[model samples]
Target: MISAISGSVAQSFRPPAISLAARGTESVQPKGSDSGKSSRLGALTEEQKKQVEQLKKTDREVRAHEQAHKNAGGQFTGSASFGYTVGPDGRRYAVSGEVPIDVAPVEGDPAATVSKMTIVASAALAPAKPSGQDRKVAALATSIRTEAQAELAAKSRDKLSGKDESDSKSSALSAQAAYTTGSSPEKGSQIAGSLLDLFS
Candidate 1:
């Protein structure tokens, strides 16, 4: 029997504050000052220059992080969105970003769901340095995949032993419960070993 699963997952990233000085400078910039003229009239203070460089670095990192998710997720992911903060240089820089990923299981097909979850987990960890949310999504996908594998193992066991429909479903439910709660280490291990054998 196919387990019911739903919902989507997105990984969002927001770096920590660059520095205390940078934060203070952000609040003091004139709202409507001409950036070009100001740069031409007087060179930026060393602190302002450091803040601009930090913002530039953050912008590059945010773009790369989202792009990694998009590239690995393929059709399962949507376009990335960014949250911007204006730098001391009066240019907008991406301070945070998110990439939405489809995490819903394929209806009535545990094998297909397993495959999809594997891809989803891979996408979540595709970046060089995954954020906390990215790790959570990966862990969720892994749990879903394990459940699907348990279901598949149950079906295979029933077919081999010639169990009737009611008995088959009971076995499947038991297997799913064992995997979910990890109540019986031996039983869980047997199911997991069976899954490996079946897939391998």
Candidate 2:
């Protein structure tokens, strides 16, 4: 029921490279040292250049944060991942069977609870008219969130309250805070930010 691939093969599975122009990189311009290494910008305006540069900047910033997370021991949970991937045709998609929320819940932590509900909120917020990843994520998120809210509402105040609890319960409560709108990762899609929204 499980399959694995080697790290080298996995590393090779990268997205298409961005052109220098697309990445908004500068040319090497030293005094009397034009060694023919230059970006090929064919007719793109200054505004276009700036826009491409901004996109590159955002891409790098996001990746750096991601690396920092991993460096600090952040790992993917049942609710995290690209719900859909972009294809050669430049279209976005996720196969029908691979929805992130469908992954089995990681039990015993409040962070797991928040991860579940955060995904539910995102899925609920996806476009209603579109019949695609947006629709799927939104729909799934809504369903999960609905189920969770009902479940949470049924718990006694003593259970949900934090006056005094075990370490596991307290940590879980802290992790669950991400779904409450004020948490760092919950403010945007860093943790549950829409995949579709990222490219947009």
Candidate 3:
């Protein structure tokens, strides 16, 4: 007896579906809608708004320096300083400036990859003194700083370790190039062995 598979069974091994939601889309709101107003309720106040605008200017300058330092493979060192107060309306405000830092790569290897990033935040406060409402503001700032440092430190370690895979590939490429350039078979084997040992 002979058995045959149906076309539908063969077609069952088709490619998986693709989702297009990953691409961004522009949303259009209908006329006379209240959705837009509610969306902006948490924005900074007039005084805070002015302060944030000033912060943007400082941020641009710091970013420029940070980028230069990163390109040169150096360490990034910067500080954010601020003086702030709270108003009777329960809003805390402050003026702050961030000094840009130099970023450098790890020492020893000239071709070592390095990455540094910095952002400067500056602002001025309308009421520049501590109050009950300001207490919460201080706490919030402290929380943000702590969490941000922790996150950055973790992410940095992850990024550095992830480079190991790429470095192994680079070593393999170097060994292949050396072999193709008339190096002895023994030397090429040694190079490849060293490359494999890197991740080991």
Please identify model 3 stretches exceeding 4 Å from their true place. 1-126, 180-200
Q: Pairs clashing in candidate 2?
A: 110-172, 120-141, 123-137, 123-138, 189-193
Across 1-200, the per-residue lDDT of candidate 3 in tens digits comes to 00111222211111123121111112223344565534543455788556555655544543443333233322222233222323222222332222222222224322221121111111101123322322332343334445556666777788988898889999899879877887766876899999999979
In candidate 3, position 165 carries an lDDT of 81
Candidate 2 stretches with Cα past 4 Å from truth are: 1-103, 108-115, 123-131, 154-200
TM per candidate comes to 0.64, 0.27, 0.27
Q: Rank the candidates by lDDT, best first.
A: 1, 2, 3
Q: Give the candidate number with the greatest TM-score.
A: 1
Residue pair clashes in candidate 1: none
The Cα local distance difference test for each model comes to 0.74, 0.38, 0.36
Which of 1 and 2 is the better model by lDDT?
Answer: 1
lDDT of 2 at 60: 51
lDDT of 1 by residue, 1-200 (tens): 01112464333344455222122113334566586547733576888888888988987997898899989888878777666787666666776777788878888899998999999899989988988888877888899899999999998998877767778899889978887987876866899999999998
State, as a TM-score between 0 and 1, how close model 1 is to the true structure: 0.64
* Residue 165 alpha-carbon offset, candidate 2, angstroms: 25
